[model samples]
Target: MGRLDKLPPYLFSAIDQAKAAALAKGVDVVDLGIGDPDRPTPASLVEVMAAAVADPAFHRYPAQRGTPRLRQAIAAWLKRRHHTVVDPNTQVLVLIGSKEGLGHLPTTCVEEGDNVLVPDLGYPVYGQATLLAGGEPRVFSLAAERGFLPDFAELEKLADEKTRMIFLNYPNNPTGAVADEEFWKRMIAFTTKHNIRLVNDAAYLEVVPGGEAALSLLQVASPSKDRVIELHSLSKMFNMTGWRIAFAVGHPELVGDLGRVKESMDSGVFNAVQETATYALGEAFEGLLAEVMDVYPKRRQVINAALAKMGVEVFPSPATFYVWAKVPTEESSIEFCGRALEEIGTVITPGLGFGTGGDGWFRISLTASDESIAEGARRLEGWK
Candidate 1:
């Protein structure tokens, strides 16, 4: 009777139910289910926001695309970080958060019958948006055999006349896989050749640890006939998830279309939030990012070590704050998560929640405190 009825059940809620059941039984739950960072926003940024909120100018409606100061800051950060140049006036549109933009972008480019290429184990919003926009979602498999990267050959084979968009994420979610410059070049060439609009969800772009940084999809070339857009969020980088601030940047026409959607759907991100985000996107904020990143390496090591001691295998993720591990037993992903809650009092995201390609895998967020992560791993070791 309704389009919302077609959507699959939310995975996080199901996991939460199991976690609640464990808590009801008086179990001490070490939750690693969601990717929300546990750290507080840096003191300096908090101070800036507190001061900005007192200004009457910030109380007014913000520019639909974003404040000019925020857009300029984003542009400067992109150029400094990725060697990519973009016009603040035409190529940038701020989002309430990347999720808000990601959910609405499909409606701008996709139609009732178009086919959108999506990663099999990608963020669920990609596929859900496609369906909500009355478009078809064709899953592109990401397998361990290929280091969890997409197979261009397979994607080409799967693409057809109806295909209109391709969604990619690097420093990917749930899997922690990353793409290199050469990979970006190939993806650009492939999308250009096929004339499909390419959208890169770069939410975790700045989260890479002890590895080469992820490249912006815009690094390749300017838009000639084909289009490319990227969505970047401050949530993971600045521990500003609750602030709901981000931006989409790329081809001018595509960015404008996305802006039009924003204009029609809502007023815009609050001016006060944009003022603080301007400070967060500045070059000086890298010091805060460095401090936040320092916490992840040790946390990752403790979790990986615990998994190894339990006779389970998992490669420490070079990027992102998640640890993706193959399930040691043959249990289904949901069943494995349920059993972890029942046995070890630990809560993790079942891989199948990402997509069927993740059937025998599970994801753990490094968003918990180091002590909590170590204890959760220790409990799993006892279960093993």
Candidate 2:
């Protein structure tokens, strides 16, 4: 509690507290405000974790840099998924979760007062990570007109000598916007020119439509090979959120630096959990990924169709399971979310919770059961 008021009420926490209050009052809130995957982890992976627990070695401290097998698995998975070969010993490092890896990178890379380019309407963690790392988070707005992509011309001008890192998320969370190959090349050039590092969050990589995806900073084919690192999560795609299995892959030096910070932080995640992730990686979902991805669009349609009936025009969200909707009339997002939950028993995240650029919009998650999604939609019909 020592001068730690540097943060805002991150979107999910406020909604979570409200959900708890409603549940306490015997109201059945469907709890769609958070982006957590509601799907269960595949049973096959659980069996491997259970087996690993029986090994005495797993009972000992796991390696700080993860086990060789786990690292190999991560490299293998990256090669399989992205068609990019990452050296397991150098270009890969296992994280407690991608969040922790991301949270610590600023500390490892940025010195005090160094600027980090952050997205205005992207994941809250991108900014928080910069702040916690004692770096300046120079937010570049993701205007709706630009399809939520940052104006690099403006951002490029902002990146003077002090900027050290730039965060990019494709299949972006909350906004669900994807960038093209040109976007990757533009950023790679900018980072290369400025001698800054770029961190790409590929958390939603496997959830893209028809399995057609965007380019990653790590996949930019730079000869220096020290320009970018991509963070991947096993959360949404594999339903492994609680397992905390994630990794960073790219420049050997960059991954090595993050690995040193990680080594100082903790030994590693549960060896059993790492083993489980290894097994899960083998089951790539292949074309099945697109099939799984189809569910999100259907849920989006359901909630959006209902919102349309209530006269709320939703914006296109191509990747993550989110729908950005302008609150009906001129009601503020916080006020609208409050009234919706109290009167309609439906909950959502306010736009202001994301950042200043998100003030006029609210995000509805499509990651829950379709029935629950439809019910959430039906609740919106009562808004008018």
Candidate 3:
């Protein structure tokens, strides 16, 4: 309870509690509050995992960083997907999940009282991790005017000698904004000039449409990998959230440092899980990604059409399955979400949960079934 006092309330957990209460009252809830994918893990990946689990070799503790085979698979995947080459032995380190890796990274790079530049309305883990590392977090607002992208001019103002790191997430959580090559180049240049480490959380990179893949920071940061590290997750891409495995790729030094810190905290990801993930990232991944790309866009369409009929305009994202919408009234996001939950029995995420910069908006996840999403929309339409 001591250090816990320093943490902000977990907004999602609170929403879950409210939803449970509604259920207690016998309300049928269309829960779009969480970002978990509704799809099952592809049969191929599960089959590989099932076979791996029976192997006596996989029963042992995994390497603290990752198995050489797993690291090679990740490196190969990066080469094929983003066209970025990396040294598997030196640059790749596995984690329990992207969330764990992102949160623990600051501990290795930031010293007490150093400045950590974080995006407002971005993932909460960035700021929380900064605080846990005893660093001061300076937030840069992501405005809809700029397509929910971070304002470079504003970020410049927040930079100084004390700045140690910059945290970014593309196809961002809650906002559903994707980054392009130009943006990545600019960010790499900015961090390089400041001599600051850049950390990009790329969990949604593969959760994009068929033709357009999200650009990797690694691709732009290249020879400058010493200054940047990117984290990717199997959770969104493979529908493996519960599996809890991800990897960090970057400068050998940064990856090594993170591995050291993780070693002190936990032994490693389960070997069996790592073996399965290695297969997921290898030859079998592309077709599964294509199937995912096909499914989510239609779901996005269903949700978007419903919101439009309710007069709730939103930006159509090229990646990620979230819709960020402005509140119809002047009510606070919490108040708006409260009304939706109590009157309509639909659990939505209030934008304020992301940050104060997101105050006038709310988030709707496209993770529900087509029928469930449509029903949620119908309820909203019926709201007087």
Candidate 4:
């Protein structure tokens, strides 16, 4: 089968269709499905981009592996935020967005018949990328009983000589599960023993509204020494989702390999966007991030309280702008979420849209506006 034929349907498209149907019926819908932030990019960054766009230097084809200044800024941010150090020249590669980097990563290492380990309940890109790279994707369960972490024993059983890489997302999508330092240490040891490449999608790493910063894999394993890489984005950090600027940092060789794949596929991020990102990571970092993150904690509280009133069981975590909860009724996640939209005119994500392992769960995104969150919560409270 062709690579495209091997892939499953894109989940969010189905959700969008349902939402559109509800809207067409003149139902007032409060969409809490997709995780795109409803806020605008920080004004400071926008102003910088406006000026940068007029610079003749940035109007060219742009630097293939990011300009020196942006790579240096990314390295410095890693040191300041995660307390990790990497060589700006060799260990950093700018991406159009973390999603694009992730889509290209499997091509760098996987050959036909090789397999990559992917979470059963994860961002769909992981497995899809593997298929596109002509590699098999082996599923690893992230059970709620185990706090949505993979069991090492289960991993050992699934991996074999052909296993090439493992994809992980902490401060994870859909589940809001953050991996602590101890978990990173164990993962590094396991992957090292198996001689497998390790990749962590750290897009939501800085989205912690709970005050305790999330740990980066680089903090535990030396990317210079280990076969590891972490992809970080400015999308969530600065409300720059549409800007499409992120970077990958890790083993110099791995970073270089991904860069090679990107060279053939795309021309790299717009230089103006990269400059704006550099500014975002520089002096404006703290204040702008604070402004972006300040809203999530209260939004989370609103949804959590409403879910509590409805007697829904939530998988508690303060990491991402997502609330993962069990389906209160006997229905599957699809049925429960469908009923929620039809009966209450509120949209929540079905866990089955993520994977079969997510069948009994549902996800609520805190990315909606305050008024929308309030309305959605009100509707959910009356749902049943």
Highest TM-score: give the candidate number: 4
Clashes of each: 0, 0, 0, 0
Question: What lDDT does each candidate get?
Answer: 0.86, 0.79, 0.86, 0.93
Q: Per-residue lDDT for 1-384 in model 4, tens only?
A: 898899989887988899999999999999999799999998888899999999998999988899899999999988998899899999999999999999999999999999999999999999999999999999999999999999999999999999999999998999999898899999999999999999999999999875456889999998899999999998998888998989999999999999999999999889999899888889778888888999999999999999999999999898989999999889989999999999999999999988998999999999999999999999888876
- Model 3 residue 220 lDDT? 78
Look at candidate 1 and tell me the lDDT of residue 168: 93
Compose the digit string of candidate 1's lDDT tens values, residues 1-384. 356877878887878877787889899999988799999988988899899999998888788899999999988988888788889999999999999999998989887879899999989999999999988899999998887889999999978878888999987898888777788788888887888889999999889765345767777657434489999999998899999999999999889999998888988998889988988778666687887778888888888888888777785467999999989998998999888888778898889999999889999899998888988878877786
**Cα RMSD to native, each candidate?**
1.5, 2.2, 1.5, 0.9
Q: After superposition, how far is residue 239 of candidate 2 from its true place, in Å?
A: 0.7
Using lDDT, give the best candidate's number. 4
Q: What is candidate 2's lDDT per residue for 12-47, written digit by digit as tens? A: 677778878988998878666878777777666667
Between prediction 1 and prediction 4, which has the larger lDDT? 4
- Model 4: lDDT equals 0.93
Q: Which ten residues in a row are the worst by lDDT in model 4?
A: 206-215
TM-score of each: 0.97, 0.93, 0.96, 0.99
Report the C-alpha lDDT of model 3 over 1-384, residue by residue, as the tens digit.
343566788887888889999999999999887888788988888898899889999888888899999999999988988899999998999999999999898899788769899998889999899888888889999988998888889988999999999999987887878888899888888888999888989998787877467888888788334588999999988889999999999988888889999989998999989999888888888888886667777777777777787888787676787888888887999999999999989998999999998888999888877788889878877776
